[model samples]
Structure formats: structure tokens, C-alpha cells
Target: MVNHALQVSAALADMQIFALEGSRPFGEAVVRHLGLALSAHEERGFEDGEHKARPLTGVRGRDVFVIHSLYGDATHSGNDKLCRLLFFIGALKDAAAGRVTAVVPYLAYARKDRKTQPRDPVTTRYVAALFEAVGSDAVVTMDVHNLAAFQNAFRCPTENLEANKLFVAHFAPALQKEDVVVVSPDAGGIKRAESFRQRLSHAIGKPVGAAFAEKHRSLGVVSGEMLVGEVDGRIALIIDDLISSGGTIARTARACRQRGAKKVIAAATHGLFMADAETVLADAALDGIVVVDTVPPFRLHAGPLKDKLIVLDSTALFAEAMRRMHEGGSVTDLLAGR
Candidate 1:
């Protein structure tokens, strides 16, 4: 494996990187790839359930990156994490830091980017405003629910990293000889699946088929039965940005199996695994599931789904992006495999 830290220059010598209490492990993984140590930060809890976090070391006139994955879990709600992150960024700016960038692996409220119903709240835009209010210069995240909404919502510079290369690197060799079809769990994700399919086809030196399952989500209930494109006797690979409750992917897997798909696998960037994911994802039709280690599988237990789950490391990808951003290199070139 390549040591990503060796690729860094003195340009990052003065950079300040911090991982909050909930995100220390992932932050450590990112800094490990960059061959740097985590900067000191202090978090204190007050009476009546309030908390505060601030940099222990000086950050004056230094480029700072805060690693925080704002995903709700048993320990903390998404709201709590978001509040803390914003407060920390505000503190950094108040300390006269030159720039503060939020490196959020699993951005929360991204799915609520738009309104399907009347008078719906655009939480994604509100979240963007929070970051901007705290003097955030930029935001970096991976595989958000809607790329367009994510970019347009943030006034600050935003980098949306794709896990395509990583997934391709993992799946290509294994499926190189098999007849494969990439299926989007929903119509909205057709573009994402197709983008992944093209790269995967190139990686395996073969053409891959495309498909999408009809899905309509209403008030947390998923309903749809239409399956488009052919999957008969071909390895079916379902692609999506996330697996919340596992309903969409599980339903799509069943649809693929009903249409005579030889094998059904699902690859999503963030595995939120909310609600009854452990039960839903345990479906026999889903042969395997692949997800990056952006959000830990805290909601999952050791069982059938756990046995089929594979977590890919995303630190190297984030590390490279951070390095490039700090050095003013082209992140687009990196994603394009240039």
C-alpha cells in the first residue's frame, strides 16, 4: 500500500487537524494516512447536559480541518453532533484561525434537501447555513444523498468525494469474468449507478448492463414493484448513496432475484443502517453488502447481515483530498484517476 503521508509537503506543516469526541477514531485514521498527528482539543461537559469543545493548541493564522461525521446514534443525536461541530468551528474562527473546513464523512440532513410535499422544510439548506454562520471556509463530505442539492446548498466551497474508485478496485477483479449488471435501487440514483458502472466496466475491461427499480417513498413507507432493465442470469449489483433502514436496497434485491439475477450484492457509500436495517438487510436475496467506514456499523449486531457486510476504508481517499486541497491541487483530477 502507498504511504499517503509521504506525498505531503511542508505546505501542510502548519495545518491544524482536530477530531471531536465522537469522531476521534475516523479522524485518527485520516491523519494516519496523511502521516500527521492529531492536534489537541478539549471537550468539557457541563451540568444540565450542555457541552463545549475548543482547541487546546494555538490555531492563529493556521489552516484547520475538523473531522466530524454527523450521524445520529445511540450515544448522540444528529442534532447534538451538528451543534457541537458548528460551535467548534465558531470557536476556531474566534481564535483567529486563517480558515476552517469541516470534513464531514456522513453529512446529516442531506436527504432532506428538497420538498416533495407542500411547506416542507429544506433542512439541507439550513444545515449549510449553520456551517456558513460559523465562518466555515469550505466543506468536504463523501457520497451525499443528492450531489446537486449538496453543492447548491453550500455557499462555501464544497467537495463531494466519490467512493467509485474504491468500490471499483474492490469489485472489478472479483466480477471480471462474470456477467454483471449495475442496478440503482431508485430512479433518482440512476446517474450515480451509471457513473459507477462506467468506471467499473473500464476497470474490468468489459461492458456492464444498467438497471433501476421503481421506488416511491411516502411518509417512511416504501412502495414500488417495477424493475427495469435485464438482470437474468447476471450478477446484480445495487448502488446507492446510503442504506437507511435497508428497505430500498432489500426490496430491490428481491426484485432482482425475482427477475432471475444470479447473485445480488449492494454497495453504498454510507450505511446508516437505521431502524430495522439489521433485520431488513438480513434478507437471503442480498448475497453481500459493501459500505465504506464513514459511519461505523454501530446499529448492527453480529448476525447474518454482519457476516455479509464488508467495510472499506475511506481514510486514504479523504487524506488525499485533504492533501490536494491544502496544496491547491486538483481534487477533480484525483477523482478522475488522472
Candidate 2:
């Protein structure tokens, strides 16, 4: 282990890590876990609303990683952040950086991977193309909406970090003596819920029940009433890739309570609380909510719902992945909890 640590340290000699404006806090946490400091960078704003960002120090022939989470906030839109990241990457490549990897914790437009409507825009693919065009060598993100679609969209190497292990670690001890059931908010997320269920079961050394609620969306309205499997007297754990608008989570929590679930906890990777999500998710049916610090809970305010919200740290996971990639180690092994 000492030798391996030394080798990894050596590998990082030529590495450069930069955090964009929006993700400074998250990037600092990642660097803290890696026992390093963030590299210097500069960002300038123009009177015409244009912006520029570039590394302050040299990055020539270095393995550069730019940490930016593409989620909109009150200050800057998602498009603004994306454009800044792309431009910074282009500047790095233009300055002769050996490799540039985009470390996006919460990738925007990932939900639009497929075209559900006629003449719909495939924004996910377009975003992938923009990254490639900027000369990005690889991209890393956590728990994308569709793993297959995300992988296929990018010709460059892409890493999708699963948050199941993190959730399992968080829920195992408390649930060991309780009757637990993992639930998917909609039929489409059955696979994701099953994966979490399997991991949680193994962690607690018991069988975990599985269920899914029926969800149908037309235009912008969501209407569904059907729910499968039994949740009576059991703790219903609802899982999804993200929570946007909080409609699905609120609906699922209500159904779980209606079916006699003792407690309903919603766990998702990204917390993109858009629109009136704060009000919608504050339902009494939901006992608790869990999410990672991918997209910060900027929209949530002090309230009962804020009291129940739990945000877990994902820096260690990303830090380890970066270390493994730099040291030519196995990211697959890391994910397998080895």
C-alpha cells in the first residue's frame, strides 16, 4: 500500500485541477479528499454578458481535470456554465494540455437523451458533441439519467459513477432491524431501484422487497394512480436518478403512505429542485429525503422539508476515481467496493 501510494503521488506530479465558478465548493471538497489544492484559474465577465475563464498557471502537457456541475442556479444558467467549461477546455487544449477530462457532478440535459415527442431536440447528444468539439478527452459524471444513452452519446471515454454504494452505506445500519422495501417512482426506474435493492440487501444481510409506482406524463402534466407490490407497515425507500420539480417523488410518497407504508424516504443522486419543487416536496407523506451534493440544494429554504433533507458527500468517490485514473488503477474495482 505504501508503494502504491507513492506511485499515485508521483502520477499526480503533472496533474492540474480547476474548478469553475459555480462548482468551487464541490471542487474544493474533492481536492481535499485527494489531499491536494485546486489549481489557479481566472474568470472575467464582460459588460455585454459574455464571460471568459482560463488557467492562470501553466497546463502544457499536464493531465487537466475541470470540475463543473452543469445545473442552473439564481446567479447563472446551466447554459452559461456549460459554455464557460467548454471554452476553458478549448483554451487548455489550445495551450497544449496532454489530456483534459470534464468532471461534471450533475450533467444538464441528460434527461433529454431521447426524443419522446415529434421533432424533439436530442440535447444530450448535442451536449456530448459540444464537449468533443472542445477537445475533451473524457467526461465523468455521477448517476446520469440513462447510462447507455450517455455512454453512446460521447465518442470519448465517459464514466458514470453509481451512487448505490453510497446509499447502501447510509441506510444499512438503521434498516437492519426494520422491514424495508425499495421502490421506484415510476415503471421506467425499476432497474435502478432493483440495483439499489440488491446492494442494500447485501449490506444488511437480508432480503429487501421491491415495488414501483405507475407514472404517466403527457405534455407537462403528470397523472397516475396505480402502484404495485406491498408496502404496508414497511419502510418504503423511493429511488430515482434525480428529483426535478419533485412531482414524481411527491406522488410516489403519497402512494406509499396510502398503501400503509410506515415511512417513505426518497433517495436520488441529483437534487435539481426546479420551479415549485420546494412546495411540492414538502408533503407530509414524505418522511425523509436524501441526495448527494452533486447539485446543491440552492432552491430549498428553511422549513420542515429542509429539516428532513439529507445531503451526502460524494467527494470521496470522485476523488478516488480521479486517483485511480491518474495512477492507471481500476475504477471498476473501486466501484465494486474492493
Candidate 3:
């Protein structure tokens, strides 16, 4: 880890770093970490369900970064989120903010990066177009559901930050060759598992085998999984993008255990525990669960999985990005995670 807190100060006296967000805690963290001032606002909702906003400071010609995450529920409408985002970003744009850069950590509709089914909409590109329509000059997001979605959506430059890099380094030392088996929880994550395997193999200086478990996500039908690689008495690291209801994760652990795996640990970017997820995950898994602090903060709540949960901070990551952009440096270098 770097010793200093990376700073992003405006080069020109007129230029400023403005961050707006849905969650006050995440937004406030970005503001404090970057050493920027906040505009006073009473952002609340009316009884009639109308959102009300009052900006206390003028933001004419300042570069604003709207830091909002939309990755929990499949109802991730980036275009819709952008629609609401415009109410905020547009105000700044009209206020003469020099430019608006979207600092969305969890991208919505990222899964629909391509048209796998007939007549299916490619929402990722649509979300990109929405940002452009709402006057976004650039965007910085973490762990996009689909990598190419960023490039396809924006005319301006976009950076796809990885939470995986954080995990690979953080967890590599504790993993033994026989103790760790890189397992993708579903078929959709084969590419991610391959990348993880490569990282682990290079780190350990040995071949790290890969395994993918299949699960059919329908009603009342359990997934009959077939492990493609060996994991007998080995630690299973099951990695995925997000966990909503905990069905896939709980079942993944169960399936891995049935295959004679010694232990199973789950990791993901977004942890949106909607239902009785804590009880499900806590009772099912053999080891722990690691999640990134991207969406709503997880510490504010309590659950059965609290003892087993590890929440990683991403504030420094975004704050560093602010410094890099301000310094006229390469954002790609941060994404490559070298």
C-alpha cells in the first residue's frame, strides 16, 4: 500500500472537485478523503414521494463527479439512474460546472453488456448514452458487470477499476497450493475465474487449477453441480460479482462441500442482502465472506453473517483517482493493478 493519502487538487484556481451521491456516508467519505469542500443541501423527499433538493453553494464551471452505485437488484436501470442523476448533475451543469465526471462505483445493467437472448436490450450501452446525454465528460467505476460496457457507452474516457486486484494481494499469502481452489460460482464467471487463477498461479509460482460449478437458477430446482477441476480437501474460493438473495452462494457452498472440498470462502464486489441472506450465508458456508464497500455501507446493519463478513474500503481507491486525474496522469495504470 502507498504511504501517503493521494490528493486530487484543482490545477486551475477556477477548477474544483465536486462529488454528489445518493448515500450521504459514501459521498461524505469521498469529500473528506479528497480534501474538498461540500455544498450545503437539504436533499430529502416530500411526503408525496417527490424528491426535494436545495443547493447551498454555487457550482458554476466546476468539475463534478457524481458518485452513485447501482448494482444490487437486477432492476439496475442505468438510464433511469441517470435520469435521476441529471436532476443533480444537470443542476451543476446549468450552474456552469466546467464538466461532470460520473464516479459510479457499481455500474447498473452491466450484466446486459451483450445481446445473448433475442430482442434483449443492451442496457449497458444505453446507460453510457444516458451519461453522455446528461453531459458526463468521463466516468470512473469499480468492477463493471461487463468490461466492454464502459468502452461501448461513453465517447469520453472511462476507467474500469477492479476489486479483484485488492483481493488477490490481500488473500494470496494465506492461500496454500492444496488449500486454495479458484472456483467460479456460476458459468457467467468463467473469465473472472481464469483471471483469478492466473493471478494466483503467478503469485504462488505454480499452476493453480480452475473449477467452475454449474447451477440452474429456477424455482425449487437445486443445482446439480459438476466440478471441472480437483478440490478434494482444498480451500475453495468462490468469487462472483454480487450477491442479492444468497441463493447462488449458499447453494455454491453446499455443492462445493458435497464434492469433498475441505472449505469454501465466498468473495464479491457488491453485497445486497435483500431477504434472510445473513442466516442463509452464515449457516451454509464453511469459512468466511469478503465484500467490497461499494453500494450502501454494510457496517450500519447487523446480521448472522456479521462475524464472518470482511468489508474492504474503496475510498482510498477513488480518492487516488481524483489525484491522478488532477495531476494529468494515466487512469489506466490504476485499472491494470500492477
Candidate 1: pairs in clash: none
Model 3, span 109-187: residue lDDT tens: 7777877657979887887777777677888888777676667767878887778777787678887555678898878
lDDT of 1: 0.94
C-alpha local distance difference test of each model = 0.94, 0.93, 0.71
The order of the candidates by lDDT, greatest first, is 1, 2, 3
Model 3 lDDT vs. the true structure?
0.71
User: Which stretches in model 1 have alpha-carbon errors above 4 Å?
Assistant: 1-9
lDDT digits (tens) for residues 9-53 of candidate 2: 676888789999989999999988877899999999999999888
Q: What ranges in model 3 sit over 4 Å off?
A: 1-15, 18-21, 39-47, 52-55, 71-82, 114-118, 176-178, 204-206, 217-224, 297-303
Ranking of all predicted structures according to TM-score, beginning with the best and ending with the worst = 2, 1, 3
Give candidate 2's TM-score.
Answer: 0.97
The number of clashing residue pairs in model 1 is 0
Off by over 4 Å in 2: 1-8
In the order shown, the candidates' Cα RMSDs to the true structure are: 2.2, 1.4, 4.2
TM-score of 1: 0.97
- Give each model a TM-score: 0.97, 0.97, 0.83
